[model samples]
Target: MNRTTRHLGHRARPVLGRSGVALCRIGWLALALAVPSARADDWLTGAPLARQLASPVDVAWSGSPLRPSLERLARAQRVAILLDRRVDPDRPIELRLLDAPLADVFEELAAREGLGVTLCDGVVYVGPPETARKLRTLSALKTEEARGLPAAVSRKALARAAMRWEDFATP
Candidate 1:
């Protein structure tokens, strides 16, 4: 007798039978849940520093030096702000805002100075346009690279270790 036997396995099994379909659906669901969905404003929402940067502040600067103004703001907000060496710290800037978020203030300042601003590693970096544009991408790449290493190595890579001048020997 020539009866079709699905239990025989090999060519007898269907490509996507009940079990296969169920497994595929479960796999897709697991994948969806495993990887988080992100939005453009995720950084502002997720990071505490980012959220702090979004808090409103009343700024009044009348021909104030860039560096001192930024330092004051950083001190007040308790957030790290790094102004690139290339940018002129003593450059005078005039700004007045009743109540504006720090991020918007940074954007306006950058625009006026023809510079770029970016937040990386819980610090706001103000620098050349190209550097600002690449900072986030560079940070992401570093994080991704670290994730592939062993736990101890990854922790060391991520840690912000400060070195003194004595750590290096004269060549």
Candidate 2:
């Protein structure tokens, strides 16, 4: 087996007595129930409208240097950006935009950067919500597409973009 598979296989088999196994199974079941499963409906409905609004008092970051500001904003905005690398290839990233309609902005941004954009229901998701707005405003933004996931890029791609944004932001 490959190194990764071998490692996973080793980790999957836990050394537990019968009672331990039973307890583990019970714990897993409890967790399964506690964590709500994602459904198509959840994606469509999104967070409530009351939760969707953003406060102007929130600080805006240009990039990684300003991640603290973004994190603070997310607490109130109920929005967060998931960088492409941080997301599972199988799952769509969640995006919440406030104060602006995202359709055209997303399309233009993706095209300019040759990134991918997808819109489902009212949400516009690009790489991640954190950088999506800034990206859309870039003059370099071109035409965007509602295509399937873009080519897999590195996790560092997001860090780089965020840092760039911070650097460009006016003090």
The TM-score leader among the candidates is 1
Task: Name the candidate that leads on lDDT.
Answer: 1
Report the C-alpha lDDT of model 2 over 21-48, residue by residue, as the tens digit.
Answer: 2222222222212222322122222345
User: Which ranges in model 2 have alpha carbons more than 4 Å from their true place?
Assistant: 1-59, 66-70, 86-124, 128-171
Backbone Cα, N, C clashes tallied per candidate:
0, 10
Span of 10 residues, lowest total lDDT, candidate 1: 1-10
**In model 2, what are the clashing residue pairs, if there are any?**
62-165, 62-166, 63-162, 63-166, 64-162, 81-129, 81-130, 107-144, 111-143, 112-142
lDDT of 1 at 74: 68
In order of appearance, the predictions have TM-scores of: 0.65, 0.24
Candidates in order have lDDT scores of 0.55, 0.29
> How many residue pairs of model 1 clash at the backbone?
0
Estimate, for each residue in 66-93, the C-alpha lDDT of model 1 and write its tens digit: 8778867766666556677678878898
